[model samples]
Target: MPPAIREGSLVFPKVPVLQAAGPLGLCQMVETSILNILGYATLVATNAARHRLAAGWKKKLFEFGARRAQGPDGALTASRYAYLGGFDGTSNVQAAYRHEIPLAGTMAHAFVSSFASFESLKPATSLLGPSFPNAVLAARDSVFKLWHEKNFSQMAKEGELAAFTAYAMTFPDGFLALVDTYNTLSSGIPNFLAVALALFQEGHTPQGIRIDSGDLAYLSREARQQFKECEEAFNFPFSALHIVVSNDLNEAAISALNDEGHEADVFGIGTNVVTCQSQPALGMVYKLVELEGKPCMKLSEDVEKTSLPTAKAAYRLYNKAGIPAIDLIQSASMPPPVCGRQLFCKDLYDDKKRCFFIPKAVEELLVLLIKDGKLLQPLESIEVCRRRCITQLQHFRADHLRLHCPTEYKPTAYATAEVFPHCRHFPEWRKRENCAKQTRKCVHQTLTRNRGEEITYTSQATTNALPFKRIEGSAVACCCRSGETCEPPATRIPTTSERCAGNQTQKPGLAVPHRAMCAACECGQCMPHSRISSVRRGISKNAGTPYPRVRACRSECRNSATMTIGSLIRHAHRRR
Candidate 1:
């Protein structure tokens, strides 16, 4: 039976269904996020030692020992890698002044402490700003969480919660406020949500909220519920608020959060990220893997011990359509991809091309944090980054993909799978035999699976952990380039005739998306929960007019197909 509609014809529960599958650009924040975590590979053993190839066992062990020789001194500086990568924004004026990198950070519980006794409040705020003007001043949830009337008055005076939003308006790029510091998913959630409803709260939303303690899944769910609750309580709709993640955040943990419908803006990759609790140091080393004259390579039984015999900088190649095609690592000798995907694709899989070049298209630092401790440029306020991110996501199209189906940074090809540094090494005697066996295994595995689409890049390092050295005189491979451009494979979708069997005069009724959309329909666009204003003062089509009774999506035709990037990708996959 057709599921019966409830409430005599309102949009009903389509909201939850829609939110389940919202926009794609909303998920990918590669440049901003990666920069926040890449700095710490400067020294020493990592939490997890790379066990690359079993064959080069002895040499691999020796190489690992060599790495330890850099010893305890480097460890001190190595520990600061995360900070160098961008996480140490604890009002770290020094780090900011040093690396010429932005010391990105938010406010702490101390922000709330400033409001102590109102007498010292003004000096307190001034001191707070001067104390850490470089850091993005994120306020904590010190204003609310009160059950008393006077507390509410204090909230009004301090506008602590409101101040976060106000601070965003004036200093949009200001460090974010700790939105959920006080019962993040509950009381604090509603107040921030109250700001957005009906209108396209499309501009900058909340600073950032810390999801302190709770079943993140349930907390995210409750967060949505509370927004809905406020909209209902005040009689309107609302968008989502900025949420920062604190407790436990890693790749897997991040996946869980986004999976549970939580879209945290920034992740304070503390404890775990800094500790490298799982896998220790990247074991990155700068060595003369190749010297001026001949082809050099390390022969080892341990795959990780094998190092690519060259030094090269990585490059990003884009298709004609400007989509990221592949990642290329090339030495000074290698000619840049002049025309086509072949050279780019080859460079993408080379062992010497392990390091990824920073992507230019994605949102990145518009201003450097420091230059010789003399603040080279003002750090972009957090709001600037956030808005740039949103705009990039919207305009950049497929540049944003799911984590699982990430826009791959295909490495350079032709680079041998010789281990560089993270793994182990083996004798040439064992390596030849092992290589034969591995090649056999690879071929057998490929044949057995017959999946026809195994993503095989000519191996970079045979194993995960191996000794690494920057190649100073590595003979550069100046391969000839195929003079043609890579193209964004045109995905021809179904024609209207193929989709509907006949030409229609017009699209009638609500867009019956190929799959139902999660965003609320606003002026024909789907606005996620974070983009709408609350019923009180958000944008409205029926502005100044009396509230119109909510009605069913007034479409008579039961058409099932509407256009969307996701559906098109799915359809393309089905055809394949």
Candidate 2:
């Protein structure tokens, strides 16, 4: 699947995203660990991508959540994945060291408050060791020249200026001061500029300043305006200085800043990105879908909880504009869908809803990542993954990626009735079991009378009592009881009630109700009892049916060959 695939996009459900076809014990042992790792990694990466989208493509985004993360390990993971999701850098030093991610940060309030006055800068030394005193005098003279104010010492807080001066002496080329330690407009900006101008005189360029409190948008604008004033007055490049913002910022906050028209060049995000406060958990589960070469299914009264059966393949269908239109899942054995050929697609849970379209291009989503317990290729670098994510997002339609009233990207997961006709009836049979108490009895009686060839009847209340329809006009004969007539295949189904009545058994000169007679015709049941039992056993084991109907069928039925009781009882559990 594409890295930027949005939420609600069906990511090949019923198909294995990571298949472990090995010894059963080995597969079972690794399930929990794999789920745990993939779940959180995917969650943080997606959250970071959303933040990137909200912050826009041009702005720099840094991960500043190490202290706020769950633990040291979580902080490392968040930093790595956040960078992979398009963040520019991280404040976590260990993450930057380990992953080679660019490091970004600024001074704290403690650093500013620790400085008392000009005397506090006495211990600070610059790169110009012997000429440090002369450099400081030159820097102060340059600041005075820029502002043309002789009383520059009284213009801002002495401690703040001392702090900025000390930091500049330490990292003159990479100094990014935290300006909100005292007063943003009144003292912080002015003190930062005085030290920045001093750094300029010492032949080193200052990086930027950060605002950690107050109205960020307004403060950034005012700070930028102040920098521009100094740039015009002194004929320096002060207007180009960066304006970084921090203090519990999030995606919405960045967007709001954009809306309010601010000069913020970088965002230092922390708790929200690392902790995933908007959605704390990613609901990814590990389930066995195939074992011993047989398909497995988990049925649930809640349709969404029902697992898809079999090993399958997923294909993303793109329209002519190179935008993805639909994601289609099919059994692994089926050939890949071809472009320019009309294909039928059905909704995962809805039987009545369907569509047909010819794709301009089709991309097989599943790839062989590992073979013979060895990786097929080297893992992608964080930068490569980041680029892939950003590029993939751009291919999607704008409306589908929007935050509000976004159009849903349609996905289809269908078990073609042509290949698995019995599977097509599973949903209908499950619904029948829920709607009628007598469905099990009906199935038992039909199985007994028909000798397990096929089901001969179904309740009219559970299904539409339409006349029997053929599967794509195929010549295959329907399974019927002895002396019962089988209608010839028809291209169009006859809707007349007489056709359903004629297919049913009736007494001479006796009147029979239309619905009751319609129930007697074996319209859609063609798969043998053995095939149905295979499907039933797979579903019954995991579906959590409340009743003992399955156990009863196993004990009571003398002819094990003619079992049909498992069909209706497979999904008898209540909705969860």
Candidate 3:
């Protein structure tokens, strides 16, 4: 067995942890974990065009696709199968909505192109302004160029450059050109810079330039030169313009071009960034695994192909250095991966456990994601998230990258849990067998088998993984607010058990399903009646899993007191 490694960044799962971010150390640790998870096998986009693509799923050329599915529910199975994988955010709005996700983008440059000039764009911009200030820029880059002067003119007309500056603040300051339509390096930039200089003189600030075509490198150089040369004429920045590099931009190509000090601000990539163009479309199909209440997962030949059974949450453990060290797939009731991390065992009916881990910054991202659809807080704009991605990519370790030879971002989980990124297709060629099963078992019994004859399975964890027993909230990470315990009422106790099971004789202040008998108790005692015994018993409850904190008396009214299993469970349920 490995020595108990001291621990990395540890995060406590909130009933939803996405609301507030973990600490910087915790945040980095989490980010590393998920970056690795997503970086693993990858959620590749197959549809390079029309936001739709052909998937690896088999096509059944049944003389007739489906003349009629059985009566709605009867045929629902086949119907669901047909469109099961061929869905996009737009095509499957229901899916996105249910998952608390928004559909992919609609309206594109094509839509904006229909408008011939800036004047044409006015009505639309005016219509969208109250809600979407950036819509104008996003829709028509060309219209922006032609009427930008007018836009500045409007700002100057409104009052002074301040309004224009303020207006620009809401709008991303970058101004990219469809440089290809006209001369990007030659006439396009020179003419545009002249206009920009004219605007700057009028009090409008030109943010940056975008190069859409023509030997991006050459055009970029030309654009820079032209902008610099015309600075006196336009008063444009020689150093500050962000050149958005688009046109077949991806990690590799960008790296090569970036090495040359290519001039581009932000990338205006479309199909590639949005569509995952390089990866052929194979729909990422998700099913209701153990819906309502049942154990389930797709049983693929590859064991790692499965998922977390039932309702599970994702978390990351950060190293002491504040970098993510692993990605953990845990159940709702599991304890975080602190020293006393709990493991879910079905036989014991563990509510949660840390099922998976990877050496990367992934958890931070997960924490930022919405939980129970209740966001920790309103998130920053997409632009902020995008900027973060760019910033993080710049600092990430290179080895964490596996562009061509795609592989699972290897992670660590419980010895009993199914290992992930297990070469499902090439088992003989691979050799990671910490928890790899050598023999196949009844997939039904384990729900580990897939359509193919393989023992792939979702690892089922116990509820013990969840943070349930803390006095007020989860124990994963504490507010540690003052760095010292605060003074409490004479009745208040410090232990988690005591906190939940307050003084039963006291009034039930809040709805603490945790300590049922103490429903009236507000004093921080493990149990109102048991408070006296607890002092003698000592705090013996384990940290992570929900173990019985208080021993119940045989009599509901409680005359004599000994540990009763029924009382133990009753006290546990009260905390809920």
Candidate 4:
């Protein structure tokens, strides 16, 4: 069964995010592997979501964590899940291509710093000076001279510009400069602008500047101020330039930057995005909730560690305002919530706590993703999952979405009479008070009735006890015919010769079960009551009338030779 869908629904810990159902051991082998995969995937996705939320709706968040990821495969997993958690794009090319996610990246710092000096451009340096004069060749000599004159930091800045000029020559259409090699504000930005202005004048628009070091919040503000000043002075569109920040940024750091008034347009998240540094594992668990038709439970000293025992379904209850108000959990076999009916909810751990809501809308969150070991639906697209994350966030109130001190969301058990009967704990709550009263009354009656009896209690009392010794003797023996004495006129075991002769005289169709013979009769035809109890094991209740009626024996014996085939078979076995 597919569960209802609801946006901004808090379903985890309220109900299982994934459920497996089958016979007692049908899915036993796959539980651990399933939980591990789900646990890691959920953790990364949640981490990505926090970053997206922290970045705000307008700003873009990109996954640049391939190299920092656990492995190449892990990198792919991160990129896919990050997109689902609302990231705009990813740096992993394979992930982008496979998942249809937008691919994003530009020149790295090493790419920009690769060029040393323009003089090293060879014998063609002077020949090409006029053609690329202002952007590359014109400043090469002066920049190299400063590099030889000033500190190593200044030399590094010159190299950055030298490389940027080369890259501009290569790809003039998109010119995003990495401006933090030596110093973001000092030499990097200045050299970048000098080359960028030359590009702008030549009818090319510079894309943006990237900051890879320093206090990102402070650097972004400084870079934006410079860009604004240049736009006014140089009379070009500098304001349109994007300020990309790609330091050690995580969700918390992003939120902090936002709070402190950063001017960043895009965030390139790496280690923290893919690794989920703060909470690396989701700790998801797969437990056996049911065995065949019976409910199963695992006890733990920590109540939170305990698992809910039985098949279950989950629901989302919306308030009158159409905002999700509570998550309701129910037995899978229980009837679903009906429209216009008041649905009662109980706390998962607390029996006394209860609440009721007449929902404006009801939604089930689980769908039959798999059926009988086969997938029931195609996997949702990355775009669809990403949009779903955003849509779900929008349905919740702002208080719950806060990055710090967020409002907590909890799930409640569905507890109407029908729902309650299905819940083992809910019904017990109703019976507790009555049970206590009845127990007290019974205790009082027991004490009152036994008040005068001299009672002795001992550990060995049961072991030393006798079976009705005070009243026991022998049950009075009754005659099978006259109800007088059980003693017969002659009591003697028949010899083998006589036994064989008796067997020979039995009815032809008789074939007795080996152990069903009676112990009380030597004549081969005794009442069923005279047979040992084990003789009746093979006898079905409908196995015809018990010991079919027999004609009176010649000597009025308890066992007669003219008994029915069943009786004769049972009797021959007795003689054997």
Candidate 5:
């Protein structure tokens, strides 16, 4: 996995988190632990931050993912990370208690449904409604009539109303209702309003309403409109009520809600928050940069996968506008950047692409988290981390943090020629480049040398021990014993002309005789088949497209089991 940069810092395609010079074994041993710790935490935190950003800054964002998390430990981890990523609170009680995060959520659908069988008071049977005749009873009857029009089960609606009444009686001050168990508009809202109005008469303020299912934005708006009318008609205290929406909300859904103009006062986000539904892993990794005081780098065909080969100090250089102009990584031995001097930093891959900045502020990014194997810095509070996250996000440019097609913010190395003159990465990079050139040169020479001749360089040993059959027209290096041939099994199938002419001369549809085919060497060179007992196909020079394929000799001629024409060419090129 790739390393994770600090939050709100300019993120690019590939960015290193930390670089150090230390013993190889010491650094390598802790790689797995480093990856495990940062991977999920960073992903969850980033996801939570995105959701917070999508939901307006003023709106309440609650993390309710504990129930859906892997386990109790996972729940706590998710809750802590979510809190640090700008979540207002978490529904996980243990997380709240442990992390000192604010706790929220009063009840679920089960709590409301528990009172479904309770008896309710009607206008005719009870003095409660008729006692207030023209004022309360009139408004209640009107609202009930409107709601009852679309409601099919009067009994079910009554049950819901009874449930609301039971909840209000239990916790009169905390009267928020989950209003989507049945029909939200027809049954839930009306029943909730009835109980809410009663609480208001007793000089109690109804907390709010929650819509768990349905079009949340539309439902919230409708519910709010109804509450406003009820406030005016019944002269009840409903104006300050909060409308909460919770239905598997993630960043995209929250963004859509904001765009469509939702009336919801709070969002209870769950699955996507803890699990990081969109991107589950952060791909954070710890790699060895330098060992034994000497710069070291991992060699790979993929440059992005390779790590920088030195102990480096990273700094954020702020421009005149107080925005980060560039993130500069320099050799640890170099002096910290000064404000007045011009800072020249170049892209690590493309040396020509450089940026010069006269920084107003030069702030070092890395500090001693641990010293002498003991932690130097104290663990930060969730609130402190959350505030820091927000502060960092404010510094990040809007263009760099867009939901789609974010602009890349590539970090540059300061004075690469001077600082990294003896760095291991450059030499390794040049070595690979040279190896490629040599491979190509040897391949060209072999193809030219063996052309027009029925090359038969076969080894005397293992002549009868070859497992795979040498099919005359086979494009692939290896084949089944049946002598039947087709395209290579891999994605690298050679075209018709290339397949026919790859090893030996095949006149159109005519198969070249087995003895006439080119024999591959122990070192993977293409020669006459007479010197080699058996041969297998080598790596294709042009992957997926048939080109210079050097079959490796099956007999013990060189180091390995077999060699390829490509390998032979590489060997030849290296010798020269």
Candidate 6:
């Protein structure tokens, strides 16, 4: 998925984003390391993109979080990903050099405090007087002329002025100062105007000023007003100077500033971008979904915990306006969705919520990154990725990207009875059985096993007893007693005898003996006789297999729990 895309818009409940098709040992060895690298890199990149959305596209955003990052490597990674996520530049010199990102920053407060008084300017003045005396003298005279009528010189600090003057003299064309060391409006802005007017007189343009503390919105506006006054009074273009603000800014803070109407042209972000203060960790896990050409699934009592079975493909459907309407997941072998065609889409977890969509465009999101353990193409550069992020965001609706009460970008899976006939629409509670049936269908369709081969169909069973097998040419249906409806596998509760049988662990890689009926011994370990008798009659008539003797167990089945025969088989396979 694109980094600019919102979360929850493209969910893969049972879908796999990364697939490993090599030896099991090699796949297991790389799982943890792969997940760790992908997780944090994605988290910080997404966080930076959110900041960019809040700051707006016209405003400049710089990553100033090297000091707040985890370490040197963390800092480098944050810088690279942040720029790729839409930031314009970074303050980390090393990151800018290594990644070829533009570098942007301003003087710190310490630089302002280093100058004590006018005496401190002697060294800089002696060094620079011969080179540019006329420009310095003109700027000082213009500032003194304003003090006579407005009396602004008394309130301004001489040390800060000396610092600004020295800095302007050293780098007149790129002089951007930090203006909140003493007083932003009363002293800092006034002193900066003096040096700015001097630089203007010398035919050099000063960059701007940065406000690091206090109410940024109000300060920026006031500073802009001061610049306007100087521009009109001195007859220079001081009003055009940029106003950069930085002080623990994040998405929320930037959005608030936008609401309050700030005069800021650039935003310097730090802690929130690098540390991911709002959400420190993204929950990305590694799980096996296929092994030896068989579909694998993880089942849990919580429906959300159940993983989707087998290899799948994801597609993004777009409406007429080119805005993404739905993300569709289907069997990898299924043909891709086509434009101008109405397709049936159902909610992955909710059967009641269904819709028919005719998309203007269909995009296949999963592409082949590696083939035969080698790269299929050269890796994309950071510049290309950053441009892609920006371009894609332009197509989404404004409401979806807003900070508050954003409209939801709905996601629907493309699994219908038409595609997978056995997968009839079912409620959330019955999804386990539906998923099991779908898994069997996926395996059959993908593997294409030969005739006479048996495929095990396991429902929620109490013990590791004989698993129901589907013969190549016959159907395996559940049998119920006369006038008694067969229960759905998910809701069926294990009987006391069945639970007791389940407690006895079976040997690894060995199938437990089939029991047509539990032994009627002193322990009273058995299922209801009616159901057992019905199943025995059904299996014997359909498969023509004789029933085996029942196994007697000593323990009592006092605990009742919900479990699937598929889960039992998985456990036994793991033990092997």
Model 1: per-residue lDDT, tens digit, 1-576?
Answer: 001111101111101000001122432333333323322442111211111111111211111111222344333333333332223232334434543434455555555434433233232243224322112222122223322443533343333444443333344444355555455543455434432321113233334345656676566566556555554554444324455555654546655554566644445444454355555554332223444444456656865455455444344455556655454443424544444324313322233333223333321111123333354445554334324333323333343333345454334432323422221222211122123222211110100012222211111112211221111222111111121111222222222232211111112341211111111111011112222223212323543432212211214112321223333234333433
Tell me the tens digit of each residue's lDDT in model 6 across 310-348: 666788889998888888877666678999988878776
Which candidate number maximizes TM-score? 2
Q: lDDT tens string, model 5, 212-249? A: 99999899999888888777877776767999899899
After superposition, the stretches of candidate 2 with alpha carbons farther than 4 Å from their true spots are: 1-16, 122-125, 128-155, 417-576
Q: For candidate 5, what is the lDDT?
A: 0.62
Q: Lowest-scoring 10 consecutive residues by lDDT in candidate 1?
A: 12-21
C-alpha TM-scores of all predictions: 0.35, 0.72, 0.37, 0.68, 0.66, 0.70
Clashing pairs in 4: 2-366, 2-367, 3-364, 3-365, 3-366, 3-367, 4-364, 4-365, 525-559
lDDT of 3: 0.33
What would the TM-score be for candidate 6 when compared with the true structure? Answer: 0.70
Which prediction has more favorable lDDT, 1 or 6? Answer: 6
4 against 6, candidate with superior lDDT: 6
* Best model per lDDT: 6
The candidate with the higher TM-score, 3 or 5, is 5
For residues 231-282, what per-residue lDDT tens digits would candidate 3 score against the true structure?
4433446455545445655556655564666665444333343334455333
Between which residue pairs do clashes occur in model 6? 14-308
State the displacement of the C-alpha of residue 301, model 4, in Å, after optimal TM-score superposition: 2.1
Better of 1 and 5 by lDDT: 5
By lDDT, highest first, what's the ranking? 6, 2, 5, 4, 3, 1
lDDT of 4 at 409: 72
The global C-alpha lDDT for each of the candidates, from Candidate 1 onward, is 0.33, 0.65, 0.33, 0.62, 0.62, 0.65
Query: In model 2, what is the error at residue 169, expressed in angstroms?
Result: 2.1
